[model samples]
Target chain A: MNILVCISHVPDTTAKINFTADGSALDPAGVQFVINPYDEFGLTKALHIKEAQGATITVLNVGGPETEPTLRKALAIGADQAVRINATPTDAITVAKSIKNHIQANAYDLIICGQESIDYNGQQVPAMLAALLDVPMVNACVGLTIDGSTATAKAEIDGGHATYTANLPMVIGGKKGLVEEKDLRIPNMRGIMTARTKPLSVEEGLSGSNTAAKAFRKPAAKSAVKMVAPDQVNELVRLLHEESKSI
Target chain B: MILVFVESWNNQFKKASFEAVSYARKWADMAGCSVKAVVSSGASNPESLAQYGADSIATLDLAATGPGMAGQLSTMMDGVQGVVVAGTAVGKTLAPTLAALIDGALSTNTTSTPSSVGPVVVERGAFSSKGIETIALSEGMPIVSFVPNAIGIEEKAGAGAIESGSASGTDKVAVSEVSVASGKVALPEAEVVVSAGRGLKGPENWGMIEELAEVLGAATACSKPVSDIGWRPHSEHVGQTGIQVNPNLYIAIGISGAIQHLAGVSASKTIVAINTDPEAPFFKAADYGIVGDAFDVVPRLIEELRAFKAAN
Candidate 1:
């Protein structure tokens, strides 16, 4: 079986988020970039399946030259090869189209991606890709197993969980617990050096996209925290009812 | 015409759907157009859609039509100027598909009403939660999905008409079976949540967390490590890669808050951290902090809550 994993290059979780002078784009001046944490689960799960079921994993990303370091990290981890659609992913549709272009040529048995990229948090890419490919897709997959030609997966729903069984050529958006963080295989020195020699294909991005971020601003600061003493339960209830009106 | 997809499960309109309807109604009123709600299940009560300001409700029987439900929804969007859906998982899937099918743009997770722009101008989160972005969709008949719990649900008096529709054929995708986890409240829908981490020691000690959650009418969640160690179900994991929740209250017990964990719950309205470690990073983000041992403090906290409840 051939598996494809989608990865995103994002600011390290610890990095301070700052805006540019004009506040139009993210200010990545001194921020450290890493593979999106959510995507790590996708890559790790694919590697586990590859090791257990003899499947090959190919990592894909849509970003510019800066994303190559993260792509190489994916290769070091366990991907057999990597593809970089050289483009600044502007919107969900453009990113989906880019992935679809690669998927059209290669018949992947399974495509796995993070539920959402930590950078943009635009959780639409996986569903959009599945729609473009016209294949069955599951989101927030927490557990997965393969039985012969069918793949059974458990997806985290709003209140409960839903189990889905789909044939080959299905897409899954992974959340936490799909694979343990300890199970992540970090490539050794040799693997890292050799990953540079592996295939790192790049293609032109689609143009003429209409969706663009017109302006960016910060959410208004939340009101000052009102401390209701532990003994003020009735007061809290009254405030919630009459003042906050939340109830 | 503007279309609103009123999401319902088990024959009840979700609170998020009410929020969506309120948004759709506001937009429709501004655009001088009629708003109609569509539901996938025929079992849904169409009358409830009117209370939230929908002018009409259309129930499409798609149990037989399978997973091409998006295509069917797109067919309904044929004459509509715009479509509004709750930015839940289902809407996340359907809205983009409908947009792609119509060759239009989709603005997802919008927080506010559109500006006076031609298509629509809306605000969406960008760069994690670091910033908000204002985007204008110029494409005709844009599809927009509002983030769940982002907008408040309001009610308006209305006597809307109900229409029934059916789609031919069966869904290509079939839900072979549903294995629902036995829990009092779903994590995503819970207004309050109590989560634990490695600070709780073993899975057996989870009784305290569960007790506190039960007292507060909140769902139980665990950090990634707890889920990784199989102490808690993966469905209960909350983090960057897990389910993001924005409940009214989030109580972190014994969890030395990690940034990944904070990312999931930061949207929560009030955060209360109870940990033995005073220097835990969660204290900086929490609205209330109690520096004490969980084993010693949790029981007392529960006792206090029970006593407080009885008095109230």
Candidate 2:
């Protein structure tokens, strides 16, 4: 089986997010980069499927050279090969188009990606990919299993859950409960050394008008904390109604 | 016309769907147009959408078809200027796919109105709820998915016209199935949530947490470490990578609030924390804090809740 896993390079979750001077884009200085956490779930799930069924996992990314490290990390985590679309990943449309162009010639059995990237939280690329390919897609899948040519997956729905079944050549987005942490593979030292010798191809990004960040600004600061004594329930309610008006 | 995706489960409209319809209605009013709601299930009562300000409702008999929500919604996006959906997992999944199918731009988890311009501008959450961002979509209709529970629902009386639609059933690809746990409230839909962390000691002590949750009609959650160690299922993990929730009241027990965990619940209306450590990080983010052991404080709190319920 052949699988394509989408990956994105995002700032580490612990990094303090800040804007550049003039507030146009993300301030990259002092920001540590990492594979998006949600995407890690996709990569690990792909690796698990590959190990279980002898599938080949290909990692795809839409970013500049800065994202090569993320691709290498996927390689270290067990992807057989990687493809990097050389671009800044300006918006979801551009990224999706680049992916579509690259995969148009190849037929994939399964396409996996994170539900959303932590940095922008756009949550559009996988869906966009599925639409562009005209294939079935499921997002935020919490569980998945294969039965012959059919794949059964559990996707998170509002207030409940839904089970979906799609044939081969479908897309899925990863979320928690879909893949356990123990399933994550850390490439051995030899695998890390072998990754340098593996194929990591870079393709030209599609040319298109991309959305530009006009300005960046910080959110309004929260007010000082107010203390309410445990016995002052009535007072709290009165204050919420009269002063806070948030009730 | 503005299109709203009315989310439903077990033939009931979700609370978030009401907000979605309200938002679409408000936008339609601003745009000098009408709002239409689309449901995947024909079994749904379209007339009820009128009370929530939907000018019309469209239902597709696809409940028994499959889980190709994006494919089904895409066929119905004709003559629509804008699309609004609840930014739940399903919405987050389908909205982008729909946008891509239409070759449009999308904004996720938006919290405020879009700016009127050639290219639409929308405000959305960023930096794990630490900031808000205004993004501009320069091409096609903007597909906006609003965060669940962020927008308040408002009712307006109107006789919304109902329409039925059909589409050719497509072959299923990548079939999916779910086995829901019995007697457990889905964390996302719960009004109250009781969560614990490593401070709880072991899975054996989860009975206290369950008891508190049961008494309050709440769901149970665990911190990342707790879930990582198998004390709780990954479905109950609340953090950046896990399920983010914004319930009316959230109670954290025996947990030191990590920044990741706080990001998930900081949007909640009210938060209370109980931990043996006076300086647990959760206290700083909590609306109320009690410095005590869960072994001592949980039973008392449960008793107080029971007394309060009985008295009321």
Candidate 3:
């Protein structure tokens, strides 16, 4: 089977969020970028599948040259090839369409992506890609197993979880439940050495609807904390009811 | 007309559905349009949406599950100026599919009704919920999914006339239900969350936490360390890297408030922190703080909450 894993390069989750001088974009100064945790989970799952079933895994991203290092990291983690759709990804719709263009040129038996990127959290690209491909998709997929042309997937729902059975040429949007954090692989010395010679290709892409960020601002600042004594349960409840009106 | 996609799970209309409908109804009032609710099949109590601003309701035929469901929703786009969806698993799937089908701009985690509708301006969570990004869509239909619990449920009477929508044929895939509820509230949909950290000692000590959560009608959540060490399932983990929740009230007990954890829970409306360490960083970010031991404080909290509920 052939698998394509989509990854996003986002700011490290621990990085302090700040905006540019004009508030049009994120201030990259003093920020560290890493693979979106969700996407990393998906990539790690694909590696598990590849190791077991002998599938060729390819890592794909729709970003500029700056994202190549992220792609390289995926390659080091065991992907056979990496493809970069050379464009500044504007929104999920456009990014999905662009990835669809790449998929149209080359087919894959299975596609895996994070439920949503940590930065934008749109949760659209994977669904959009499946829609554009007109294939069945399982979002928030936790457990997945492939048997020949069939795939069994389990996903999270509002109250509980649901299981889905779809054939090949389907999409799976993976999340934290798909794999534990400890399962995430770090690049070994040999893997990193081999990554330098691995295939990393870029292609021009199509664009769809553009949903640009008009402005950015921090969430409302919090007021000073009202510290209560340990025995102030009654007062705390009163404050929650009267002051915050949140009870 | 504004189309509000009402999602259901486990044979009931999710609370998020009504929240989204109410969200769209307010937007419709501002935009000078009517609200048309299209609900999925098997969602019980479809008419109750009338209480939450659904002027008319349309249900997808029972057989419309996969691509057929998408096509059925597409057929409802005749006069839809914009689309509203809840920020649930189902909405995340339908939002982008609808955007692709309509060739429209889509925004998820939208915080409010349109401030003004001409350009369709709205705010969405950004940077792992640390910031808000205002997005404006000029052309085509604006497809937006509301952040769960961000815009609290509001009610305004509506007609709620039910109608049947078209259903395309089935597909090759077969989807089935796996497990039902664990008798606990879902984390994202919870208005109040009782979250803990490793400071609680172990998974065996969760009885008090569960008792407090039960009394408060809140979901239970954990910090990354708790889930990492297997004290809690990954689904219960809340942090920058895990589920980011924006509930109305979030109570963090035995948590020291890592930067990553704060980034996720900071979007909550009100926060209360309880920890033995007075210097724990969570206190700075919390609206209220208590320096106490969980074993002592949690039971007291549960008792206080139960009594408070009885009184109120």
Candidate 4:
């Protein structure tokens, strides 16, 4: 079986997020970039499938050259090959369209992607890819298993979980529960050396107009906390009910 | 007409559905149009929607056929200028499918209402609510998914004309079983939430958290570490990689408030943190705070809340 994993490059979770001088874009001056945390879970799951089911995992990303390091990191983690779509992902539709075009040219039995990128948190690409490809897609999936042409997955719903079954040529938006932290493999010296020589391909993608961000702003700063002494707990309840009217 | 998709589960309108109707009403008023609500669960209270400014309600009986709510709603999108929906579990899947089907521009988890003029524009959280971006869509029609609680629910009386519709069925996927979390309020709809972290020490100590939540009628949540260790169900996890909640009040107990955890609760209107360590990062983001152990703080708070309620 052949598997495709889509990844994104985002700032580290601990990185302090700031805006540019004009407040139009993210201030990348001191932010440290890393593979999106959720995407790492996707890659880890893909590697598990590669190890257990003997499938070739190809990592894909839709971005410019700055994303190559992230893709190479996926290779080190255990993807058989890497492919970078030479485009700036301005919006979800553009990224999905380009991925759809690429997938149409290449065949894969299963497609995997993180539930949502940490940066945008849009959670659009996986569904859009499913729509454009005319395939079944499961979002917020925690467990995925493939057997021959049938795939059974468990996904989180409104109040509980629901199990779903779909045929091959499907998409899955994976989250943390897909694999535990201990299962995630880090790149060793040997794996790092091998990743440097692994096949990484770059290809052009389709062109399309998408929604543009006109401006950027920060959320209002939180106010100073009203601290109540530990002993005066009932005062807190009165304040919440009368002053805030929140309870 | 601005179409708002009202999501229902087990034949009732979710809280997000009311907020969606209210949000669409704002846009409709700005555009001098009307708001039409489309219900996907095949059952609805048109009166409830009418109170929230829905001019008409279209009920699609897709529950029996199963899993085609998006396809059915796509048929109703003809000539609709703008589409609105709640960012609920089902809406997360349905809106994108509908937008792709109609070749419309889609924006998810929008924090601000778009201006009612042409070339639809809105503000959405980017980088996990760390920054906000003002987006403009000039392509096909615009579809916006309002984050849960992004817009407050309000009542504006309207003529509640009800219409019934149906769509053809396809058995691509079947839901084998559903076990709804009964009795407890779901996190997304809860106005008040009490979430705990490792400071409580073990799963056995969850009684106090539940007691506090029970006293305040709030939902219970946990930090990623607590869930990761299996002390709490994954559904209770709220953070960057976990479920995102936007409640009116979020009380974090024993949580140090990692950035990832803050990313999820930052949208909450008021935050109160109770931690033994005074310097826990969560204090920086809280509206109210207490420096004490959960064992000492939670029980007392719960008792105080009960007393306050009795007095009222």
Task: Give the number of the best model, judged by lDDT.
Answer: 3
lDDT tens digits, residues B1-312, model 1?
788877776667788888888888888887888888887665457788788898887887654212366777766755688888887766776677667656677887676777754768888876556567888787557778887777777787555888788654234355656655565877866788989999999999999898988887888999988988889977788876677787887888888888778877877777777778878988877766677778877777677667666766
What stretches of model 4 exceed 4 Å from their correct place?
B63-67, B169-171
Q: Best by DockQ, which number? A: 4
Note the residue pairs that clash in candidate 4.
Answer: A119-B127
Native contacts retained, all candidates in order: 0.45, 0.45, 0.81, 0.72
Give the count of colliding residue pairs in each prediction. Answer: 6, 16, 0, 1
In order, candidate lDDTs are 0.77, 0.77, 0.86, 0.85
**In model 1, which residue pairs have backbone atoms overlapping below 3 Å?**
A159-B186, B64-B170, B64-B171, B65-B170, B65-B171, B66-B171
Cα-based lDDT at residue B61, candidate 1: 69
The runs of at least 3 residues in candidate 1 whose Cα sits more than 4 Å from the true structure, single-residue gaps closed, are A147-149, A219-247, B63-67, B115-117, B168-170, B307-312
By TM-score, rank the candidates, best first.
Answer: 4, 3, 1, 2
CAPRI verdict (incorrect, acceptable, medium, high) for model 3: medium
Cα error, residue A3 of model 4, in Å, equals 0.6
- Predictions ranked by DockQ, top down? 4, 3, 1, 2
DockQ for all models = 0.46, 0.46, 0.74, 0.75
Instruction: Look at candidate 3 and tell me the lDDT of residue B14.
Output: 78
For model 3, how does the per-residue alpha-carbon lDDT over B207-311 read when each residue is reduced to its tens digit?
888888888889999999999999988778898877889888999999999988998899889999999999999999999999999888888888888899999
lDDT of 4 by residue, A147-211 (tens): 88898888888778888888989988888878876677788888888999999999997667558
RMSD of 1: 2.9
2 or 3, greater by DockQ: 3
